[model samples]
Target: MSQLYASLFYQNEVTEIFSDRALVSYMIEAEVALAKAQAQVGVIPESAAIAISNIASTALDQLDFDALAVATGLAGNIAIPFVKQLTAIVKQNDEDAARYVHWGATSQDILDTACILQCRAAMTHVEALIHQCYRTALAQAEQYRSQVMIGRTWLQQGLPITLGHKLARWASAFRRDLARIDAMKARVFTAQLGGAVGSLASLQAQGTAVVQAFAAQLQLSVPSCTWHGERDRIVEVASVLAIVTGSLGKMARDWSLMMQTEIAEVFEPAAKGRGGSSTMPHKRNPVAAASVLAAANRVPVLMSSLYQSMVQEHERSLGGWHAEWLALPEIFQLCAGALERTLEVLQGMQVNAENMQRNLECTQGLIMAEAVMMALAPHLGRLQAHHVVEAACKTAVEKGVHLKEVMTELDQVKAYFSAVQISEIFKPESYLGNIQDQIDAVLQEAKGEAK
Candidate 1:
């Protein structure tokens, strides 16, 4: 079922990078680790370990997973049928050794190991996609670093800013999220082995050794205790996924807004047949951005359920773990889809620098009020300067005159600055302070850390 959903919604390049086949291989690897742990604890004979290792090393096709699934009810699941099949394979020549395949471990030990492996694989794709998106954003920022546009606050034009500066902010957010995911690797890949009741009493003397050996075999960190009941790790993964998707969603929303016909400062690529609304033949809608926003919005709701599921009872809460099983993969798949589409949208974006500049002058220099006010602050008291600027702006709006014309009408405004100074204040380049430098810093940091 997980594989089907992933194939349907996540059959993109990123999904291919972290395929379910790899996840199944990881599950098989965990089963082999369990067999080895049993052997070290004297629960299984040395011969059984050798045989299990040999069998696990072979292709998954070597085992009839379909038959095993029916036999042990492990279809569309990982751990149970894995153990059952390994036990069956081990007992083929020595029936007595079948009892040792699972030994003191519960299903979660194997399941959690498999999940970590899957996460590790998925993280590889996540990291790559994040870097790609950040690089694209940096490039876009550099291209429009000085491209002036109106900055809106509360849906109103509040100031003048470069489009590059805005894009740099989005890139910086992605860079931070990538760092966070890298930092979480150690915690997320830790082993899970709390046994049936969050205790290793069943293994007694060799519990620690078995856990260490199991972690070594699977190439994961050995946790201090079984985390069957403590689900913070899963919650953390979900939260990170949510945050990354949300950032991309914000970018998508920005694109959607900018591509509005009345504000066509930016647009997605004009695909031959894409984004066509049946009723509007002339529409080149921002469908990629819209899809990304929808994916991002839906992911948070799934992640919210994951957060709520953390309050589980006892050492092994089927309710909580089950909730995670349902929510985690969906989050992974949804996030993958969003990232894929976001990358596509950004890489092929149609940046209208000409329109951006034209729109910068759309309000006839009213966007420069702050600049005008700041220039007048030294000559007038700050409050008095603000009042003078505000009154001029109001008069300009009512009279259909430019703010500069209204400024020319006032003796106080003339005494504060000349026409050249006013023109410099309205220049878009002056307002984009350190925006490119910030992008360079973020890109450098991301590259250094990724390496």
Candidate 2:
């Protein structure tokens, strides 16, 4: 039932990557690669390696996930039953090949390598989606480069800022996420080929050679040491993923607030029955924003489990490693879902420049009081100007009149500025200090980073 929203959050590519069939198929690929590597180092027969590789393609559908689940519960891991099923299948083609199946590799070695392959595939899809989202963000920043809106702090209007200022921030976050993913991949996508207790004592003289050959066959990097006990590399990927989802949540949060009926400064692009309430006809909800925000809210708690699972017992752990097996894939799935939804939102977003202008004006010139304060600061002391404007703002709120009008009548304000000068400071457009310069600088910086 929870899968009802799977299509809304994730895509077919994500399903294919983490599917049961793909999982076994990857494990089999690891087995075949290990056999081939052993043969390369003369630990197994070349003919047996060829036989295992030839038979592995048809072995995917034969796996019984139900049996594997029961075995996993009894044995404390899935790799035990999975390797048994793999060996049984390979034995039908050549008994000699079956003898060498998973030779010198422990269950952790095969399982960890398979999980890395899965992550490699998942990251490919996620990176493509992130790149798409980043490009859309870049387009929004450029299109709305001078689109003006009120900047808010603590849910209240503070000053006038360009829409590009906000969108460029989104662009920069996703751009940096790409680098985090790459750095994590370099550390985590390496081979995990240590035998029992990470010593490879079974392989002995051929251990490092088999490890190198396995990495070469899989096109993954060779690790400096086995990571059975050190889980930080994988945790780094999960942490980066959490941060990416958090960034998406922030972007959605700002846009969702702007879509409010009272604000109406921006909106999710509307379509027939999209974001419709069952009872209400006028609702155009920010559905993507809600999904991304939910992912953001949930990922941190799940990531915490991954971090807690880092404290393993010396060579192996009783419950900690199993915790990671549960959490890491879930972290990937949640982040992938958020990335997919955010990409859709950014590509189809609607911006209302007129509504932004109205909202800025709705504040009755109080939003521009900071500009007036600065103007007065040149003549009066900065603190004194702040006091004068603060009093005028309170008076405007009390009388329900514009702050600019109240300020003109104030003696302290009249002591410095003329009518035209007071009006200039009140205009929201006049208060855009360095928004264009900031936008230009960010866009230029994003261009280099995106490349």
Candidate 3:
């Protein structure tokens, strides 16, 4: 089925990788490799392996896709029809070779391994995109390390922080995502080669050898045993992808909020016709963030289906295993789209540092209430200091005067500090406790990850 909004949610390269043709190709590759591996272990004649391999070269052209599609509907899975067509193609060249075509493998073996092949290739691109995002975020973090901005809690200004600190947090997330992908490679990229019902019953004596050789044939790892009933590996891949998509979504939400008209501290990268409102002439939207947010919202829901699908009947799943077919590919496609959109946003994201600094003062010095309270806490009791600052804050708000102006007029404040000290208390930079250190720690960690 074709999606109307596929272009908005999937990158062309990713779509190609998970296309029907690619799945067919991967399945064919699995079949050919299986034949060769069996031959290596003396399970099949070398002539059979060679003939099957030779026919596989042009097997795609020889097979009828239209007929295969119709057959798939009746068979309930593509592997059965695919193997039938492959065996028939091999028979035309050498009848004897066709006998060993799929020798001791089941439909799930080829299908699962083929899907693994597709996922292995797809994740390479995902890992690269994440690295690009990590690099871009780190660069931004370094560039804006000292650029002061307001930190919000409960959607209102709470404290002071540097823009670099914010970007570093983003970079840090991508860095961990990279680690997760790397760690999962060993578990996810393993071959699925149990003959039938997670046992090599058909290939009995040489089962272990064939399993090892089959995995080696495709340059995939050999799992300790078959994963036909063990769906954790597949679920783990979905889980990590959910985390990555969630991170991108979070960044998008933050960026979109920053781009709000009243709080224009950041803007999406500008291009002709990009992020423009269709009806509103003065609107500049966060288009990239919108795409990412869409992916973020959808990927998790898809992941849930995969989690639910983990309950296989016994050795092979009925509907449970089948549930993964569409959901996993769609998850990959969505993540690809989200990652690409994130790259575009991060690489050219516009920072309104002036607006950031200006907005910090919009609260009329009330943002600096903590600094003043802490300064007086040493002279008065903590409660007394808090009570005095709380009253001054209310007066500042009611009179429409700055917190510093009200603080200077308070007798308690006057007795403890000079006018110059009172002025310093309201400076956003003065109260940025350890922001540079925190940003430095994030940068150092990112640099370590790069190595």
Q: Largest lDDT belongs to which candidate?
A: 3
C-alpha TM-scores of all predictions: 0.90, 0.96, 0.97
Instruction: Write the number of the candidate with greater TM-score, choosing between 1 and 2.
Output: 2
How many clashes show up in model 2?
0
Q: Estimate, for each residue in 207-255, the C-alpha lDDT of model 2 and write its tens digit.
A: 8899999999999999988889888877887898899989888988998
Local distance difference test values of all predictions, in order: 0.77, 0.86, 0.90
Query: Each candidate: RMSD to true structure?
Result: 3.0, 1.6, 1.3
Candidate 3, 140: how far from true, in Å?
0.3
* Cα lDDT over the full model 2: 0.86
Name the TM-score of candidate 2.
Answer: 0.96
| Winner of 1 and 2 under lDDT | 2
Off by over 4 Å in 1: 1-24, 40-43, 62-78, 93-97, 433-437, 443-451
Model 3 lowest lDDT segment of ten = 1-10
C-alpha lDDT of residue 115 in model 2: 87
* lDDT, residue 68, candidate 1: 55
Residue 451 in model 1: lDDT: 97
How big is the positional error of residue 204 in model 2, measured in Å on the Cα after superposition?
0.9
